[model samples]
Target chain A: MKKNPQTAACLLIGDELLSGRTRDANANTLAKALYAKGIELIEVRIVPDEHKTIGNALIDLKVKADIVITSGGIGPTHDDITADAVSAALGRKTVEHDGAMKILKAHYAAKDEEVTDARRRMARMPKDAELIANSVSGAPGFRVENVYVLAGVPAIFDAMLEEVLAAVPDGEPETVYHVTGEAKESDLADGLRDLETALKGLKIGSYPGPTGKGGPLTIVCRSRSASVCEQAALAVKALFTAQGKEAEIGQGDRPA
Target chain B: MKKNPQTAACLLIGDELLSGRTRDANANTLAKALYAKGIELIEVRIVPDEHKTIGNALIDLKVKADIVITSGGIGPTHDDITADAVSAALGRKTVEHDGAMKILKAHYAAKDEEVTDARRRMARMPKDAELIANSVSGAPGFRVENVYVLAGVPAIFDAMLEEVLAAVPDGEPETVYHVTGEAKESDLADGLRDLETALKGLKIGSYPGPTGKGGPLTIVCRSRSASVCEQAALAVKALFTAQGKEAEIGQGDRPA
Candidate 1:
């Protein structure tokens, strides 16, 4: 039976990432989390912190995927224009969220610090949006429609993601099986092609190690149906066997 | 004087990436190299190994960027469909290039192995493409029009990029200046907005560190003209000074 898998797209907004100053850790974290919940991360777009770019990208991605998650540009800085961008994209007015304001005010007051205007900026969100609790930092992330706006800092982004993921419904989890062999990718390409043609709704992947890594090739079979994935895995092993090679299951090939 | 900066985009192809199995290293490497060569990396798209999806994404990115670079899916495997996708996107026929075949043959011959059909698959390229020398591996990458096809292996990708970058012309190098202060992004947000309005053709960025990393905030000014960037940096320092906060120039703010 075919399963209609929910799809997700990531919009990583940061000029630091494009400038090669900061390596992205959020995409991989989100991709893995979404995968465990059976949500397919179909595409990831890394764009700068410009207002027009962020707004346009959000609109485009929202139309294509079931949900869109954006990271960065949510800090208390002049460059933190994600709230304004989301408002523009969704055609809503930016307003101070009551829940967000209360949380920020309480956190700052408890610490005996005055809540500055820049600190208050974090409380603003698109009208009619729900707040996504930020446990790591006082500033909460707000969700407008299908888009979730989170903090750019890695710690806060990851923490806010936990809350976001809990609120979304889970889809069919994908079953993945792996087989490793001493054969090269070229040796099994044709057979793998035929096997893929024979099987429906299954994906077969071949990864070869670099030279001096001892000619190790891994074939991975993935599908929503466990039986189909298992059968495809057997066929892959048979192909290697026919070529006078041994395909070992669970041989600990490097992930991806 | 405002200078039109050349921009580039990267299309990272692989299901492994979407599956959250492999963290991407090529985009950062490529982004840094492009920045050094004065080509701004405006966007990065990570997609799965599907042919139609890859083809459609390629066409879209090619139009928006002056140059496009794709990494991964050049291996001798069924899942390595990047060449076919490129062919479909550009409407070019896939053909075996003589130059690539010779390199594969010589590399295999030295190891006393026959050049197998699957191995020969690496030699195939879009018609009228120039061969990119793969010094690390025998399988060569190729260039068609403005797109450069590169291997997914980090070693091979880095080596092939050296050749690819050498072939492309460099643009005006962007001059960047930094000012770091104890002030918060909120403390400087208003001044930054004013400064951005006064200066044309310059980008101002504010980056704040996470909690316990202290209340350090960095302001970056970037422009093609060194004098403009310097003047903007001084103005930023003056803003911090007017707020009774010391803004130090070249205090080793992390390069973005």
Candidate 2:
């Protein structure tokens, strides 16, 4: 039976991200979270804090993937247009959600301060949207349809992602087995291609050394079935062993 | 006269990226390079190493932006489908470029190795493709029309980016001035909203404290014109002065 895996797309909204003022750590976090949850993060897009840009990208991703998660542009500022854009994209009215209002009011009330119009903007969401709790901050992320809007800051995004991921169902997680060897990527390519064609469903990746010295290749084998991954990895290791090259097996072999 | 700035988009390709096995640094590098070159990075997309997905996203981005740059999946491996996908997307036939083959041969020849079929795959590019020199690696990146393909590795990507960026003309760089103060984002919202409307084209961003403490807000003002940015920054700093809160002027206030 061909099992259809759940797929997700991330729409990261902010001008700073596009302008290189901010380096985004949210995509990796979301990708790892979704991977652990067995949801395929098929695509990720970083757009500016523009209304039409966010709305267009959100609408596109929501239609393409089962779940669409957005980060950034939801803060309390004129550039915080995610709430409005999301509302328009999902065909819902933007309103001051009572639950959000209550949370913000209490969060500010704790410090003996009143919720300002700017802070209250965090409470604005699509009508009938469900709130995703932010343990780090009082400003709650909201869910409209299949799209989840979360805070842009890494700390807040990470905290809110845990809550939103709770609703996601688990599946057969992809198994990745990396085999590092002191061999040229080209030397292993022929063997890898032969096995890659025979393996059918496994993905084989060959990455060269970081310094581009042509040695210290890392072969990554991935499959939904752990057995297939093991088989592919062993075959890759054997290729190295055959060439009298030292090889070691590990879980992940990606550069930081 | 309203200046229409040159815009670029990035398409990061690799299955490891989507699987959360690798954290991407290419987007930020590309963003910063484009920013310094006075070009606007309008959007960035990270897609898995799939032919159709890469092709579709490439076609879309190449049409929308003045330039489209792709990183990763052009290695000598079964999963390296970037070159073929880009070729198909640009309606060109994939062929072994003489220049790429020459480079690959000389690179391997220096190491006392012959260019194998797997190694030769790196030389495949769209017919009539222009080469982007990778100073660190033997495999040269290719350009098909407005699209520039580069290596996924940071050192190589950074090096190749410098070469690609050279061909792009300088534009009116966006001006960004940040004022950080110990004030609630909500408290400043009313005043900010007033100036935001009056400033017309300036983009104002309010970032709460990293710890979500509700105080210590950072107000970011941006415009294509530096004078407008100065005017907005002065007004924002004045707001902090009026509230007797210490505000510091800086260049960037984004979280890493």
lDDT by residue (tens digit), candidate 2, B154-239: 88998899998786668877788899878767667778878989987788877776566455678888888888889999999988
lDDT of 1 by residue, A42-115 (tens): 99999998889899889988988988999988777678899999999899999988988899889889878767
DockQ of candidate 1 relative to the true structure: 0.56
Scored by CA lDDT, what does every candidate get?
0.85, 0.85
Q: Which stretches of candidate 1 lie over 4 Å from their true place?
A: A1-5, A210-215, A238-247, A251-256, B1-5, B210-215, B237-248, B251-256
- Candidate 2: where are CA atoms >4 Å away? A1-5, A251-256, B1-5, B214-216, B251-256
Model 1, B43-136: lDDT tens digits are 9999999999999989988888888899999988778889989998999999999999999999889988878888888888899889898888
Give lDDT tens digits, candidate 2, residues A214-249: 567888887888888899989999999988998988
* DockQ of every candidate: 0.56, 0.67
Give lDDT for model 2: 0.85
Cα interface RMSD of each candidate: 2.4, 1.9
